[model samples]
Target: MTRVPAYFDAFLTAVAGGAEIDHVHLGHWDAPGAIGPARARAGFAQAQDRLSAALIAWLDLARGHLVLDVGCGFGGSLRTIRTCHPGVEVIGLNLDPRQLAVGFRRDRRRRNATWIAADACRLPFAGGMFDRLLCVEAAFHFASRRDFFAEAHRVLARDGVLVLSDIVLTRPPLPEEEVALLADGLEAAFGPWPDKWASLDAIGRDAEAAGFTLLVTDATANTEPSFHTIAPGRSDRPTSGDVLRELHRLGCLHYLYLRLDKR
Candidate 1:
């Protein structure tokens, strides 16, 4: 069994209390309200799946290549990888077994698809276990981004690539007071925060320290559509969404994409 830390295991067990998670929107929704709720949800998921596919295309994969997707919530990207790259064996890893349990259809499990419930910072597999590592909008949740980067470096094959999307602070550094407001915005927009802003240079430094060389870096502010989504029951204070939008308008936040190769 994977030895989850005592406190974190307790926390995750309590959170799992026989339940599921997340409905707020966060992506480039070209058509926000053009359809019904069910259709819209399906479209958003498909878009995210396509985004995953786009990221994986950079790998130039070959037959029988092994891939690991960290924090593979609901296995959306897993489905895309299996369909898009035939003969590529892939693992969908998430910390919560409940997520892995419900991520697939009754007949969806395949010979090449393996799902593991384990922490990102402590991969349970052997060294040089994966050819490509994909993490989409999930790295920020790790207890330490630097720790996860080091873990990623350790598990990836010598020539392997790590492609991930994350939220980071905008350069030209905003006022120190803006940090709290941005945190509130993130809470309003995504309901998750690492309790501190991660700047672009900070991420690069962490990855460099992990024995990896940065290959590609890009930032996108294409989250305006997500801000328009309705997440209710916060009438008491300014919605975190509002704060997020204003800060975004001020160029204080960005959606970052990074591709790093193991040194």
Candidate 2:
């Protein structure tokens, strides 16, 4: 097994409690019954549910379909998928053993969902093993998104679909200071990232080079709610939302919804 990164170990240590985050990703307020001011006021759990539902809708899952949730933090999306599509088989792959242990404990009742501690860069499965792949707000931390994409393409069947929601660079090169701030801010809040940020065009190129055809892209404005709903006394570290907001103001970043199919 590939060794886990030290900074990531530190991150898990910082947020050691189980189920502390109902959802770590910024949610889709455009989801049904979650739109407008009402969604903005909804609690963290509700917003996360909406976001999971929206991403799941893109998969078009079928009975007996095999799904892989890469970087499946705490298995929230895994549970959502398994509960919604009980006939589907779901696997959650994460680097943190603590997270996998906690997720397995929480998911014991859902026989269709399971968790594993594995690196995304080097998936330990056979080619054409999965029917669908989902990565929620966690691709940015991969050792190499390009490598992960290639692995996903290799492991997915010809008809498989890849759905990912993540923070992507939306504009031109960032100022050096801004880049440093973004990197430092993220390390302070969550953990280390290999490249920190990649441009949308670069990501698309990587996906195409990995043999995928980009099908859909949704750039959303519902970025601020996740920060707004931070529970009381969660952490004293600088808020990731503030850093992301600054990047957004500079036209340097965005949270994007991407759907791609193996070609």
Candidate 3:
């Protein structure tokens, strides 16, 4: 048997280890009562709500169009988009069969949505086939950010739009210790963080290189505190509980939302 790619292996491990992938793709882990302890459940729920809202706001999806959701985890974003844009056709692509299975089961009643197991670097669709492309929280996992952008450009119509929300390192951590701390926090939460997360400047550069015009970019740090506070209320435990406190202390979370138009 062939060995699995290291990044994929790490992704599976992180998901299995109770690191919720909700930020990247939406789907609740199906556990007996809940996936994580009560405290963790609260934090996870809060993050999910905020991330989901940001994705919808950024995409501003329209009806009667073809949309492709790359690295769609558990299909949460796809479902949300479809519900919001009733006449739209949504295709969710993911590499993990298990994740796709959960998404399929959850959204079985929605006929306008479809799911496929495929690589992000090489989507199995014709050029200019889609009107909109949305990727939430999963761009860092692509082996080549450049290739990912190129594929997005190729698959999108000339006037199409691409919305992406992902975790990005704001500035290079100065001290070596700070760098290590940041890296550790990310790895603990995300399995393995990407070597170079696209900064604001980098995002603009890449979009231009990929034949897209940058439209909007927003940092979500200020809003994060409010959402984190709200998340615990959805859980069975108190908001100040252990797991919530831990996730907060590590500064293990941050997000950026961007909108681009294909040229």
Candidate 4:
């Protein structure tokens, strides 16, 4: 069976059960340079909040906007968005049912939030159904990000917006050995890697092919501090974070912020 998603879900479940797994995404630190995780728990939460705020800011949510969080993980962002825009309708779509279960078990007060088990590449929604789509640090596993882009294009309104933060190739092809190692690590942690990571330019082309116009792209260094992990697993153990840290250090991987408009 796939142990990767389970491992992550377990960590998040623990986070929901008062355990600290730091931040899931690379945080968007507002301060100057990277700060060590001296106060890891608080730092991680703060970083997560900052990144969520950054993503939410891009949505420009209104009272009636319908927003969907693809790969919604354990519903942290959903909770934050609901608080920020109480009048908006928020639904979360995830491939892992266990994650959704854990999310519901942890937070039972979401009167207006809905969670569904679904795949990102093949969204179970009608055309032009949502005004905004937000995906945070979870699209890398899609069998094909391009396909997800097309699906996002299909499900989003004509003037809809897509905001995504993900691990991407900042440079060309990973070394053969590194690719193998990284793939193995990711597969062990999440599931089989789809091997669909694309460069910034390639992603832009994919969006264009899917009938989207790029609105903004941010690759600031502020996200580096987010690498300071605090998951339930042993901090010293090599996990997906190790792979991300290595790829990022090698300048081959980046945490990218992209905002696209359906046209």
TM-score: which candidate is best? 4
lDDT of 1 by residue, 1-263 (tens): 33222333333454367533221125644454554445544465455544566667766678878999898876767777778787899998988776676664421657788889889988998999899998887777677889888999889887988988877755325565766556655554554445346777788899999988886544353444444443322568655456655566677668766898888
Output the lDDT of residue 127, model 3.
98
lDDT tens readout by residue for model 2, 60-174: 9999999999988778899888888989999999987876776776776867777888888889999999999999988887878899999999999988999998777643366
Write the residue-wise lDDT of candidate 4 on 1-263 in tens digits.
Answer: 22235456566667667874433565777772747666444576777888888998988898988999998877888888888898898898888777777677756676778889888888999999999999998877777879999999999997999999877754336677867777676567655456545667788898999999986555557776655563323557755567666666777766678898999
The superposed Cα distance between candidate 4 and the true structure at residue 209, in angstroms, equals: 0.8
**Which rank order by lDDT, best down to worst?**
4, 2, 1, 3
lDDT of predicted model 1: 0.68
Per-residue lDDT of candidate 3, residues 230-254 (tens digit) = 3445456643223323433455444
Model 2 score (lDDT): 0.75
lDDT of each: 0.68, 0.75, 0.66, 0.76
TM-score of each: 0.75, 0.83, 0.71, 0.86
TM-score of 4: 0.86
**What's the lDDT of the predicted structure labeled candidate 3?**
0.66
Deviation in Å, model 4, residue 2 alpha carbon = 9.6
In candidate 2, list every pair of residues with a backbone clash. Answer: none
What is the C-alpha RMSD, rounded to one decimal, of candidate 4?
Answer: 3.2
Of 2 and 4, the candidate ahead on TM-score is 4
